[model samples]
Target: MNLKEIKLAPFIKLIFIIAIIAYVVLNTDIMGFVSKGISPVLTAFIIAYILDYVVRFFELKMKVPRSLSILISILLFLLILTTIGLFIVPRVVGAVSSLIKAIGNFEFDINALSQLDFDNFYLNEIQQAIVDTVTPLIQKLTNATGTAVLIVVNEVQKITSGLISLVISFAISIYMLGEKRDLLARIKRTLFAYLSDQTANQVLYASRMANKIFKAFFLGKLLDSTIIGVLAYLVFTIFNFEYALLIALIIGLTNMIPYFGPFIGAVPAAVITLIANPSSPIDVVWILICILAIQQLDSLVIGPFILGDSVGVSAFWIIVAVTVGGATFGIVGMFMGVPVLVLLKTLIEEDVEKRLAFQGYEGFQSNDIKNKKSRK
Candidate 1:
């Protein structure tokens, strides 16, 4: 090759490499492939991570043996899982059966509407418009009942697979936890072997921050959801709502999704009530009231207390994260999106502060401003 052609070869090769990577990412199921490949490792990491906290509490505070601590933690975890299963499974099955039986049989009747006399022309016109809207909405709801039932069944099937995966993951995690110190030492050695001290420290710092954010967010959410779920159960029992256990479980679980969680949980309960007791539309109204009351308490009181500054993202960004995460990874994505956003926000803020400090800027960091105000 000529001198100029030889000089351009590296640039051409770099472009080709970039094009190939982009094409593979765009055209292939790269995410699915990666998820399938790393799922076991990821699952193990999560289990070990959670168990570490419990194991540490036992070993450190309770002065239990490390091995004994691990065993205790696992047993406690299993006990909680079993208790929840016993409480939730039977009710969920019964609710599903009732829903299936009630579907396709539900009818909408507003016969009393015809007897209403609206003397004002504008009021009459508005009444007619509302009736017209309700007619089609009811028809659509009727048609969707079967689909809803199938969706619940499909969700259960996913749960079954998830449980199997969980078992395998926990098995791996037990081993990891048993070898925690060795594993951590090995990981640190590997990082330092290949990465410079500064880079290794940066990576470790980022990982620690991410872990802290995730743990805090998840624990807070779990407590919040549990409280909301209990409140829902109490309300349903007080009001004599059908499928109380099943509906309350739905509310509790979906409450993990954030922003849309309450409404999402409410929809199924409302739909089932409407279908099973067409004559008692007030029950649906009461259910809505219960949801609103619990959510208000959560948002104004419990949520703020438990999860304050955990996500760091504003409500709008949280909504966007939930939407994108749900679209990309379904329920798991929606659950994780907020904490991931928090980690990213923290990293960005720190990077910005570092850059500002490097540029000889003062009092630019958020903490600095807050400190100044507190001093005043």
Candidate 2:
């Protein structure tokens, strides 16, 4: 084909789009600028999205005006945040202080292992080896107490420094909630103006799917984590576990990450418990048991009830997503990976089925695969 006769417009457009994406991805300065500049707006949008449900409930269920509903939702959000600041924050800080003090004073008793009566020589050797291994590890951790405390202080400073940005974001969220309909209408108008009807409809449908998946996953996960945290706190309090508030907070926050969160939270909690009462090694065992029980309850009952196939992905994929996302983008990625995977999975499946149908072939659905596996 003659070079001029071959239509290069579509290829050029594709190349331009790819080049733009590559530039954004590869440029560190641009990435930093986007993160620093756009984070507040992104935060505001997320806040408005989450609070939209509460606004809707108030408007539809209570016969409240839309403006009044938005105001109430914002007030409720502020109330919850203020309560956490007043109550939870202080306790967590105190817990951290106590933990640091305890770690500073902690000493591993290597001599204690000599007092243990082991019938077998191998058992005695194994016990000694464990003590020898754990002693240096504990000493290293104890020595790093100051570093840990400094890190905590630095994090607190960062939070305090970000307050202005947070306030701005909150203000932005208020405006977003107030003018949600107009904003959405404008978005739709722009999309339709720029794209064909079918393409615009597809974009809207995908966005709605994403919203549903994200809302369900996030809200359900929050509720589920809250319940687990409360239950864990109660259990810890009953058992007189040390640093209950701090550990509970860790568990709650980490629980937002799928698959690996329980284990991640449990390790630090168990370590803290063990360090607090090294003489009573059974304390660590008790802590582990309690955490395991709470996680089981969450996984078996509360999580299922709340999430209820909202992720729409299998355990293997969820694990893969969480692992890759955590590796690539840290905790936020870990928490978001599942819903993103679900959205992508849904879109791909739909497209594949459509293509298969066009090719005069019936798609091999999920149920068919399940039946084949059962036969195997």
Candidate 3:
């Protein structure tokens, strides 16, 4: 049968077959030759790669050359890195160290708490047992936390696999950016050469969807976190909450975890404040309430203003992504899980819409719909 005569289902099966073949090749020997050491160089270049589009934007539209644009990109990249290194890093390190010190003094903090009596407090036998079990652990938390962090750092050093993987990832991203266009065009031609034009376009469209998801996710995350952090710091400092800078920073960063990050970040911050001032439990509680209010504002108010309806992944998918990421990569996995879901969701949506329109559905111009509406 002629290529166009082949049934769509069989064609899809063939594409999956090709994808499996490609995956195996990438998994086996083909990927082995593409990477080496100097991961930091690769890291810088990945930073450069993201900025390259901006560079190219200025170059083509603003009447500049590639070299000058690249230079501008490089300078901006370094300035950003330097700014973070000099300004942000110190504060981060100090906050971490302070938290550790507080942990080291945990027993003292809790013991101080136990020196009080509660009026009209009622507890069942089960409640009393639970409290007894938890109290000692809470007492030991300060030491345990510092010790746990030390153990983790040691394990990271012991594991030779992580460092190697990190290096390879950076190297791949670097080379990919440097030769992106030539490689992209070659891949496009190769995919289109064998496959139907429609199938090739689907692959291209999926890739674009994935890229858009990544951009929306990462940029949105950075923006949301920054605003929350700045607001938290300003509010906390005004109220003179203990560990304001540290707690605000932590809350701001972790707030991006969605639904759960705020709680995770806030609990620790509140605990630290409680440890620092067990006498002022009421004050600590009030501060926590304030922090929660800030989070609510961020989620409902500022968040919508910035992010809009960009990522349309639902709540159920979010839970699934978090579960999978935490299962595989622990905290880091959990942190990135939602973004993965967002990308996958976008890709799925694009594919489904394409298939619907392929057989001819009215008003199914998914790509141009947004542009047209905006123009109108």
Ranking of predictions according to lDDT? 2, 1, 3
For each of the candidates, the C-alpha root-mean-square deviation to the true structure, in angstroms, is 7.1, 5.4, 6.8
Cα lDDT of model 1 by residue, 1-376, tens digit: 2222223354357546864774565357995687676798889988788878899999999999999999999999899889868977777788878777776677767656645788988987888887887777788877876787889888888997898888888899999999999988999999999999998998899889988899888988988999989888998989888878878888999998899898888898787778778888888998898889989999999998888767766778789879976776578778977887777667765765665666665345455333211331
Ranking by TM-score: 2, 1, 3
1-376 per-residue lDDT for model 3 (tens digits) = 2324324565467646865764564466654554334444556455655776667777899988766776676677668778976987778767767766767665433344444455435634545555677687676774587676787578658668765664565455555555667888999999999999998998898788767776677677778998999899899889888778788888987887767788888888877787666667777787788888998998789987777766565567778888776665567677778877776555555555666656565355556543311331
lDDT of 2 by residue, 1-376 (tens): 2223434465357546864774555455777867788899999998998899999999999999999999899999999999999999899888888888888988767678767979999999998888888878887988988898899889888996599899999999999998898999999999999999999999899999999989999999999999889988999999998888888888888899898999999989988997788789889998899999999999998998888777777788899989976776577668877887787777766765665565555554655542211331
Write down the lDDT that model 1 would get. Answer: 0.81
lDDT at position 97, candidate 1:
81
> Each candidate's TM vs. the true structure?
0.81, 0.88, 0.70
Note the residue pairs that clash in candidate 3: 103-142
Alpha carbon RMSD to native, model 3? 6.8
Off by over 4 Å in 2: 1-29, 114-129, 365-367, 370-376
Residue pairs that clash (backbone atoms under 3 angstroms), model 1: none
Best by lDDT: 2
Candidate that scores best on TM-score:
2
Model 2 has an lDDT value of: 0.84
